[model samples]
Target: MAEGLFRFAAADLDDVEVSSAGIAAYGGDRVSPETLQILNERGVGLEGFRSRMVDEGIIQQATHIFCMTRSHLETLEALYPQACEKLYLVCEFAEIDGEVGRDVPDPIGGGRGAYEQVAACLDQAIAGIIGFLRGTGKGQAG
Candidate 1:
């Protein structure tokens, strides 16, 4: 979903409104402690963020919805059939290894090492997705 939002927010892009949602998020809560630590190590400060729920309002607003996993997509598809066409797994867009139908895993309950691995994967995938969007003329680097 990061790529979708970045593109939508891109200065030269048009016709898109991007947002993220977790069907059952730890609503109004902060990002995971380990996730923050990992982001910090990468020089990304996210202390201001407060996790929000992925509700119908969010779905209603987004034009192209991206999720981290298949379960997420399936759940949303089942619950919000009208919005299914907009739902997708962010990684699937990379067209890597026929992964066009899979999802990124959640490591929130895992150990510090798991957090590190997850961060690394996220960084790689997000970078690739953004690059794809840019190459497709969706957005330029800001």
Candidate 2:
């Protein structure tokens, strides 16, 4: 969801490469129906997205790595301590002041309402991410 939202938010910026993966994912897994439906309702197409696991190669290549929860950050930190400097909580990097904390609650295993809430949070964070990327020149003007 965050990947799709970031892609949608950065649609105008051609130079950025935005993607997301799960720490425990198996390659080629489809996104959850809840995620698909929510993004679809928002007019963000995640059609070719297949779940992939975060590997050393992916981590090494990423200029920035945003985790949805502190646990995710810790897992990555444990696996690749050398890359810890670039790892950050999504909310922290988004700099959403007064956000319920750095963690974006996992909406998995819930119903539509849970998905909706997660989507709203993603929308807010994605907007802030776009702004931060642009200000830093990491995302070039189209």
Clashes of each: 0, 0
Per-residue lDDT tens digits for candidate 1, residues 1-142, read 2323343334344633334556787767776787777666655656666667777777777766767777888898998899886666767546444555445667767789876765555555565665666565542221
| Local distance difference test, each candidate | 0.61, 0.79
Evaluated at residue 32, the lDDT of candidate 2 is 86
User: TM-score of each candidate?
Assistant: 0.74, 0.88
Tens-digit lDDT track of model 2 for 1-142: 8888888888888778888888987899887899998889889999888988888888888887888889999999999999887887777645444663367878878888888888878777777767667777663211
* TM-score for predicted model 1 compared with the true structure: 0.74
In terms of TM-score, which candidate is strongest? 2
Q: Among all windows of ten consecutive residues in candidate 1, which has the lowest summed lDDT?
A: 1-10
Which candidate has the top score in lDDT?
2
